[model samples]
Target: MHACARVGLDFLDSAPYRIVSTVDLAITPAQLFEVLADENSWPRWATVITKVTWTSPPPRGVGTTRTVTMRGGIAGNEEFLAWDPFERMAFRFNEVSTSSMAAFAEDYRVVPTSRGCHLTWTMALQPANLAGRIGLSLGAPVMNRLFQRFLHNLRRYTDERFSAQ
Candidate 1:
């Protein structure tokens, strides 16, 4: 059986789509976790994330709200679902503007490696409709590449910033 099927994801509407990107960086898990936890600095390191503004109180934790604007004018109203410092952080977004998917959840995990740490990002998406499913199928490759760029950007930003410190 397919892994997606084993996960109990639906066929068309909730057709489970996951994008996972991993990068090994020469930084401690705590250092990488601090960067990942700071949503305000995302735009600086992530090309697709153009802007992020907190919609809830300070100190990002579970239930925190944030408005994120990505490249090409795509925006999403997101809320923090889980926040585990130096380990993982997860979020769900809805009420997207100028996007195909209706809602999606993303999680980032930082694991300690012998050299430094390995950061992995996982995102599962749900299509809004039939048309959205078609769009997801067709756009999956491009989205994967976009996320690859995001991982590259994270690595570059961390290298440049931490190496200078």
Candidate 2:
């Protein structure tokens, strides 16, 4: 078992905390991307995404950019790190107002499975300092749960919305 599992952790979230979970779903990449790209669809799928006001024109190709605001900060910018059309997209979170203990990178990859699409989302944090490491030890549970909840909702939305398409 991995160190996290040995400690009774099923998974780790990326934001300096590695909490992980595996979800099975039945959805297509195009259908998933349609929802993932629309800023309005965030609240419908992601639990922590309270707001997403587009900072630029909606992007259809790779390298598209958007200033996506999330719930953890006063203002959030979600820069598109990678966008493979209906395949995959990645972005990092930058707080415009609030200063977090750890910064994070989010990678959302959509893999086409025979049954459906497999989404792999990863969030990691930048070690702030020694104190930050200690904070991670304590905050991992909350952060892990938050990420899991987000993924869980995403899976549900994708399965329900996309599978019907």
Top TM-score prediction, candidate number: 1
**Model 1, 57: alpha-carbon shift in Å?**
2.0
lDDT of 1 at 143: 87
Question: How high is the CA lDDT of each candidate model?
Answer: 0.75, 0.62
> How far off is residue 103 in model 2, in Å?
3.5
Model 1: per-residue lDDT, tens digit, 60-111? 7888888888878778777677788888777777467744665577778888
Error of 2 at 48 (Å): 1.7
Q: Candidate 1: misplaced stretches above 4 Å? A: 1-15
Model 2 spans with C-alpha error above 4 angstroms: 1-21, 127-131
Q: Which TM-score value belongs to model 2? A: 0.75
